[model samples]
Target: IHSDRGSHYRWPGWLDRINGSGLIRSMSRKGCSSDNAACEGFFGRVKNEMYYGRNWAGTSLEDFMCFLDRYIRWYNEKRIKISLGAMSPVKYREHLGVTT
Candidate 1:
């Protein structure tokens, strides 16, 4: 998992969980904004498209997870990007004859 060198990530509980899950921790160098820009941009788009201005109060955690999963699927498979000539990521990949 990629993250900044934050104190929270260094906490014993967090380290234990990462070790238990067998996830490799990849921390960016200090003051390296470029290392996180892509993920930050993606997260910004996700918040703007599905999270902002939504009344998520009273929603169950399971329901929230389901909604997020569905939205991500749609974003990858249905939402078109002008930069990709108005094709979704999945369609663009297919057009390029790329297989996942």
Candidate 2:
């Protein structure tokens, strides 16, 4: 998993968990945001498209969670990404013969 060099990520407990899971840890280089640009871009798009101009003052936690879940599904299954041949992530995976 790629993450910033946060203190929580560097804790012994977190390190143990990651090691036990066999997941490689990738940290961005010091003072460099380019290494995590893709992740940043995704957050920016999500906020701009789904979060901006929204009022969540009275929304329950469950309702917000549901909205986030639906948006994520739509992003993966319906939204086309220009970098992926104008195909949604689900379609791109299918095109690559990846069965999920």
Candidate 3:
């Protein structure tokens, strides 16, 4: 997990969660927002596009997890980006003859 040095991110509960989950915490250097700009932008898009204003009152954790996973796959493989000539990253790479 990558984050800026915000107070909440440094909180005991947050730290415990990350440590308990065995996920390595990566923090950006001091005063360098651009270091994680692309990641931040992707997270912002995810939150806005899928999470904002949505009610998950009766959704089970497993179902929500599945939804999130599918959404990310779709975002990376199907959703087109205007900056990539209106192609998804996968398609743009293929167009450039970059095999993956």
Candidate 4:
């Protein structure tokens, strides 16, 4: 997972786990936000399209939890995108004949 040097990601033991899994660790430089532009772009799109004008902002945690669950399902299964060749990511995998 890509992230800032925030509390959730700066754990000392995390290096061992990442190395054990044989996954290369990638990170931005200190105070260099452009090094992580992809993450920022996605976050910005989600916020603008799904969060900026929502009245649900004032909802209770339980309501927000329900909304999140439903939203994720819709995003993964029903959402289509031009970038994914006009298909949902799941559908794109299907086109490649990939099996879960």
Candidate 5:
């Protein structure tokens, strides 16, 4: 997993958990949001295409939560990702037969 050096991400025990998992840990260089541009872009698209467009304009928090849940499910299950060769995240993972 990659993260900026924010305090939440840079907690002392964070490295221990990552190292314990045998997966490599990586960080973006300070002040370089471009290093994490893919994630930033994904969130930008989510907000622009779904979230911000209807943000908090509903009847109640329950309704808003329902909208967010549905949007997230659709985003993961149907929205095509440019980086994933236009496949949804779920489709990409299932094609690879990954358990996680």
Candidate 6:
């Protein structure tokens, strides 16, 4: 997981949990916003598009996970981006003959 160099992320408890899960911890250098800009931007878009001001009360953890998964899929597959010439990322890739 990537994050800023925060004390919470450096805590032994958090370190142990991340290690146990076999996920590598990645932290941006102090004062380096560029390193985190892409991730931060994606999360900002996610909150704006699906999270902010939404009523999520009574939603189970599993249900919320499913909803998030679906949203990500739709975002990647169907949502149009003017930056991508009015195409979804997947479509843009295909348009450029990118098989992967």
Q: Best candidate per lDDT, number?
A: 3
Candidate order by decreasing lDDT: 3, 1, 6, 2, 5, 4
Window of ten residues with lowest summed lDDT in model 6 = 2-11
By lDDT, the better pick of 2 and 5 is 2
Instruction: For candidate 1, give the lDDT.
Output: 0.91
**Model 5 spans with C-alpha error above 4 angstroms:** 1-39, 52-58
> How much is the lDDT of residue 81 in candidate 6?
94
The TM-score, computed over Cα atoms with residue i paired to residue i, of candidate 6 is 0.90
In model 4, residue pairs whose N, Cα or C atoms come closer than 3 Å (at least 3 residues apart or on different chains), thus clashing, are none
lDDT of each residue in 1-92, candidate 2, tens digit only: 88888887788998999999999998889999998898898889889998898998999999999998899889878898899999988889
| Model 2, CA-based lDDT | 0.90
Q: Over the stretch 1-100, how does candidate 6's per-residue lDDT look in tens digits?
A: 9878888888999999999999998888888899899889988999998988889999999999998999999987889999999999889999999958
Candidate 6: the clashing residue pairs are none
Candidate that beats the other on lDDT, 2 or 4, i.e. the better one: 2
Clashing pairs in 2: none
Off by over 4 Å in 2: 1-27
Q: 79 in model 5: Cα distance from truth in Å?
A: 1.2
Cα displacement (angstroms), candidate 5, residue 70, comes to 1.1
Q: Write the per-residue lDDT of candidate 5 for residues 1-100, one digit (tens) a residue.
A: 8777767576769878877888676778888888899898877887898767454754697887787789878987888889998888888998889937
TM-score of each: 0.90, 0.65, 0.77, 0.60, 0.51, 0.90
Candidate 3 Cα lDDT to native = 0.92
**Who is ahead in TM-score, 3 or 6?**
6
Displacement of residue 64 (Cα, Å) in model 3 is: 0.9
